[model samples]
Target: MAKSVAPGRPNQFLRNLNSKIACIPMMLTALVIFLGGTVWTVIYSFTNSKLLPRATFVGFDQYERLWAASRWIISIQNLAIYGVLCLIFSLLIGFVLAALMDQKIRFENTFRTIFLYPFALSFIVTGLVWQWVLNPEYGVQGVVRSLGWESFTFDPLYTPEIVIYGILIAGLWQGTGLVMCLMLAGLRGIDEDIWKAARVDGIPMWKTYIFIVIPMMRPVFITTLVLIASGIVKLYDLVVAQTSGGPGNASEVPAKYVYDYMFQAQNLGQGFAASTMMLLTVAIIVVPWAYLEFGGRKRV
Candidate 1:
């Protein structure tokens, strides 16, 4: 009888010795920096550490104060408004623009470049440019007044009711291009045979897109959704440059609140609590989506 070889020692992690060695530094960096800092913040969030971190645990007092603040409440409301509107409009405009570009039109590259050029600029730059453009005396209002439309009041930034919408417009201008690029890439990945089949079945273009093409592009849509959602959450710089949460804090966002309480107000515990709440919110939204997308048994 042939002697059976012991399963080659079961292939240790050291088998890929060079690759594992290369990844050691990065793995340690992530664990030490990201994980360690997160843990530290979460621990301190339970304390009343003002101006600096301390071990004086207060058990939800900071969180209660955070919720009671009007500015923080306004910030959450603003974030919710901006987040919802941003996701809807960005996806709609981006997909529409992508579909148009996918129509084999002439100068497609030129159009794509023109559309995507805004994304290359930083958000601060975009916000400042829009700030000027939305200025009542020197921007769209002025130009329209110059052309003799005297009563056309379109100053969203100055109006307490619509200042957030003004910021939303600027955000869309800066971000929709990236979304379009992503959607266009997804569109390009569609198999030509699928289109042929759709045509052969006498399906209208809109129906084909709604029923089949979009479902096939689920990965791309999910990627775009995450990008937009993250941008919505971290919307501090643009609001700062554009309106500074002005018009009586109509455009205040949670990130700005975190910054103000942390650094400007010297209330570290409150800021930490707010940041922890933000993290919890993100987890609440992401965990369910992740489980639905990655978990679940297949039907027989």
Candidate 2:
């Protein structure tokens, strides 16, 4: 006699396979977009292409020219400074705003809306406004001079050594709100009993937040960090709008540098090389954090 198979196992397997099959269209669409664009960029990077891409292969000549370019090196260094400053300021300000907002203050909803409104606006618009406000001849400098303070001077955008900080200030203004919203959601989700228990034990509010609340919000903190990291890698709009990488490319970022080569300079190969380098740099910095956050064991 022949052995019989289980009744539902085959049906369940068929169901699972059907479900995966149903998702194939979406998966293929994403794969096509991602892989197609990446392949195109890689192919262009290998050629001696200009305004319009040519079919001639130039090996590593573009990479060599990129390495020898001083502006490229300056742009990379500027990006490091801007990225670190933006991350630090955004995190600190966001944490403080979120903590304060969680105190059950009056008009909490209004305050929350006010703080979050900035995130709704595009970076290009924000950068333009910041440029006007920071311009020495017309902005803070003129305002201060009008107030009868001729000795006062604040010309960060024109000063090579300090221009990055000026850009950082604008970036922080726009980004901190997003971090606050994330942290606020995390704070609200926290167990109320923890706060009550700490209060009953005579623990100070600051101490409770510092020790209990912050530690419990690790996942949210990690999420915020990753969000900011991605923003740093793609930073371009603010730099363009505010300084236009001015004062002789003092405030240039890798993204803007890549754009210049790809479009303005008509050097597609170097642009792609820069893009690849940026992707590699971001992976190096972010992959370790991602692994620790997702794969590593939880700390007690």
Candidate 1 lDDT, 87-141, residue by residue in tens: 9999999999999999999999999999999999999999999999999999999
Q: What are the TM-scores, per candidate, against the unseen true structure? A: 0.94, 0.90
| Error in Å for residue 250 of model 1 | 1.7
Alpha-carbon RMSD of each model: 3.5, 3.5
Q: Summarize candidate 2's per-residue lDDT along 91-151 as a digit string, tens digits.
A: 8899999999998999998988888888888889889988999998899998999999999
lDDT of each: 0.93, 0.88
Cα error, residue 243 of model 2, in Å, equals 1.3
What is the clash count for each candidate, in the order shown? 0, 0
Screening candidate 2 with a backbone cut-off below 3 angstroms (N, C-alpha, C), the clashing residue pairs are none
Candidate 1's error at 199, in angstroms? 0.7
- Model 1's TM-score against the true structure: 0.94
The worst-scoring run of ten residues by lDDT in candidate 2 lies at 1-10
